[model samples]
Target: MFFSVIIPTYNRLPILKKCLTALEHQSNHNSVENYEVILVDDGSTDGTLKWLQDHQLEFPHVRWFCQTHQGPAAARNLGVQQAEGDTIIFIDSDLVVTENFLKAHATALIQASKISDRVFTYGRVINTCNFEYPTAEPYKITDFSAAYFATGNVAIARHWLIEAGLFDTQFHLYGWEDLELGVRLKKLGLTLIKCPDAVGYHWHPPFALEQLPNLIEREIQRGRMGVLFYQKHPSLEVKLMIQMTILHQVLWGILSVGGRLNERTMAGVLQWLINQGKPQLALEIARIFLNWYNVRAVYAAYREL
Candidate 1:
């Protein structure tokens, strides 16, 4: 199977370098005829396009396109339009994979296609903060995901995406774009096949107190996008996914003390956890307030509509 790996990147040049380098070094597989990496730069101010152009020879498998700071949904649509391969692999620019990454996906996909073409391969993503040795990090329980169609590490036939109408451009915010497409794909009777051998180490900076503002803002954006997702599908599943139900409101409200235990109120405790070399733990704890912000924002957006 010829695969087009669609990666949407922003100002994440440092990890994007590692991500592209890993893709270029994938092991040969008979099931995989060839593969190309399509890097769509979402108008990054970090000179991502220039750096790629300068080191073009280093990543011969890579072809890049640029947009004017559009969100990932639009960038991915552009990549799919430029893709020539029959299969499309969607991954973020921060995810660095092992040498057999494509081979694993190709092998699994080819096997699944025999059973039915209505199948997509979902890979494992291990989150890590170790930039220097990202792949060295072992899998953690917190890294486990139950998402049906997260764009972090997934592969499907290109035609299926076209059939589903690609991603909605209205999801110009932070989240729900991929899963919204998944909803459409589900209606098309697509089955998700787990491909755990295809592993990708998702790298991000270690949690810090200073990053809370940006993280909080991201949750808010996710909440707004959640409303857009619900508007399209308007299903019970979408309501649960977006945390728009009364149960979500009560759960987060009680956990966060009705928004009383916010970033400002919990800053000292979060910093203490960070100081104790447990940034991941700190981030999990901070999610209490972060999710509160998201739930509140979701209701606010729904009310506005």
Candidate 2:
């Protein structure tokens, strides 16, 4: 089957380079007839478009489009509209995959299709901060995800996405656009088949105090978008996912000591963790306040509605 790898990128040029390079070197396999990398630039100011243009020959399979910072939902819709492949693979620009990634997805998809066409393949995503050697990072327990349909690394039939109405452009924020689309796909009786062989190393800068502001802002945006998700689905599951329920409120409240143990109050402990060479642990600890911020933002947005 032919595959169209649709990647929506913002200001992640460094890792985007590695992501594209890895896609460029996919192993030749019988499962895939051919593939194209559709890199959608979400109006990045960091010269992503120009860099791609200059190195066009290096990534021969890559075709790129640009939009006016419309967010990943819109960017992906544009990619799907332009894609010629029957199958669509969605991945973030920061994820670098192995050489057998496409073959693994194609193999899994072909096998699943024999049973039912209403199936999609979800690949593995291992998060790492080692920019110099992202692929070398081993899979950790924290890398495990239970998401039904996250765009981080997933492949599906192009027709199914069109049938599911693609992503909701109303979610023009940091999160939930994918899971919202997943809810629609579920309504269409789509089944998710896990494809562990198709691995992608998700790269991000190591957690630090300096990144707290942006991280916190992302959680706030995610909360706002979560409200939008609930507006679309409005199920108990959606409510729980967005942390709109009182359980979430009390849980995060108690963990964060009723918002008293915030980024400021926990700065010393987080910094100490970071200094101990445990940035991941520090980030996990910081999630107490981060999730509290998200819960508060979710309620605030719901109230506004």
Candidate 3:
């Protein structure tokens, strides 16, 4: 089946270069006839549009589009609406994949369709900060994701997305849009077939003290949007996924000393870890309070609602 890889990007021009170049060089080991990369820019303040325009010759397989500052949920919906292929692969602009990425997803999807039509393929994503050689990074325990259907790397039929009502554009914030779509897909009997061979190296800047305020804001946004997710589904699973449960409240509360051990309190320790060249560990440790911030935000949003 032909593939349309839908990627929604914001101000991520540097990594988007690697992501698009990787998609451009994908090998057709499964003999897939054609694959297109649909890049929907989410109103980036950076020079992403001009750069993509200038480097058009480098990305011949890309079918690019742009929208206002709506979140990725709206961007992916636009991509799916404009996609020319039957199969659609959702990925972030920060993910750089191997040459066989599309081929692996296509092959697994074709095989799964033989058994059942309602099936999609999920690929591996390894996080790294090395922009020079992102693929060289090895998988770590921190990289393990138990998420059943995150959009970092997953392929589905275009028709299935339309049937599931596409992504709800109400998710105008930082998170939970993809997993909310996953809930609808799950109800439609879609099976997730794992394709570990199709790997994507997720690139992000190393954690620094300067990023704390933005990171904390993202957690708060995620918490608020997560409430929207549960408002739509209103199920136990959605509640758990959004960390809206009392258990999450107690867990993060105790872990963060009822919000005292926060970014301000732990700034020195986090900075020391970064100075010691352990940014990942620093980020993980910072999550202790970040999660508490999220839990508090979610509860506050719930109260507002």
Candidate 4:
């Protein structure tokens, strides 16, 4: 089946280059009958549009669309509206994939379609910060995700997305948009078939003490968006997913000591981990306070409602 890989990108031009490059070289085993990359630029000031326009020859299968500085939700909506393929594949602009990525997805999706038309294939995503060789990163326990329908790497029929009303534009923040859409798709009786062969390496900067403020802000934004998610679909499952339940509040509160063991308190330890070449460990430890901030922020947003 032909595929439309939808990518919504902001100022992540560096990794986006690698992402696009990887897509341009899908395995020969996968027949390319108009397989295209639908890159929707979310009003990036980082010259992403110009780079794509000038380097059109480099990415022969790319068709980019532009919009104002709306969030990824809006950008992805635009991509879906303009996509020409029968099947849509979603991946972030920071994810670089293997040469056989599309082939694996196509194989699994075709097999699923043979069994039943109401199924989507979810791929594996390995997180790495090694820009020089992102695909080389091995799978780790930290890479495990229990998400039902994450947009990082997944392929689904275009009609299913249209039926689900696409992503909620109200999620104009850092998180929960994809999961919120997943909730809708789930209700529509869409089965998620795991495709372990389809792999994408998710790239992000190594954890640094200097990034703590932005990371904290991300957690807060996620919390606010999580509230929006619950407002739309109030359920016990969503409550757990967004960490809005009393259990989450109590868990994060105790782990963070009511915000006592925060960025300021854990600054030295975090940096020491980074200096010791263990940024992943540092990030995990930082999650203690980050989750506390999120739990508090979700309650605050709920109160504001």
Q: What does each candidate score in C-alpha RMSD?
A: 0.7, 0.7, 0.9, 1.0
Question: lDDT by residue for model 2 over 31-110, one digit each (tens)?
Answer: 89999999999999998988998999999999999999999999999999999999999999999999999999999998
In order of appearance, the predictions have TM-scores of 0.99, 0.99, 0.98, 0.98
- State the lDDT of candidate 4 residue by residue for 21-120, as single tens digits: 9999887874445589999999999999989989999999999999998899999999999999999999999999999999888888888888899999
- Over all chains combined, what TM-score does candidate 1 have? 0.99
Clashes of 4: 0
Give me the displacement of residue 162 in model 3, in angstroms. Answer: 0.8
TM-score of model number 2: 0.99
lDDT of each: 0.95, 0.95, 0.92, 0.93
lDDT of 1 by residue, 1-305 (tens): 99999999999999999999999999998989999999999999998988998999999999999999889999999999999999999999999999999999998998998989999999999999999999999988888899999999999999999999999999999999999999999999999999999999999999998998999999999999999999999999999999999999999999999999999999999999999999999999999999999999999999999
C-alpha RMSD of candidate 4 = 1.0
lDDT of 3 by residue, 1-305 (tens): 78899999999998999999999888756458788899999999999999999999989999899999999999999999999999999999999999889888888888888899999899999999999999999988888887878999999989999999999899999999999999999999999899998899999999998999999999999999999998999999989988999899999999998999999989999999999999999999999999998998998999998
Q: What residue pairs clash in candidate 2, if any at all?
A: none
Query: What is the lDDT for 220 in model 3?
Result: 98
lDDT of 4 at 247: 97
For candidate 2, the per-residue lDDT at 179 reads: 96
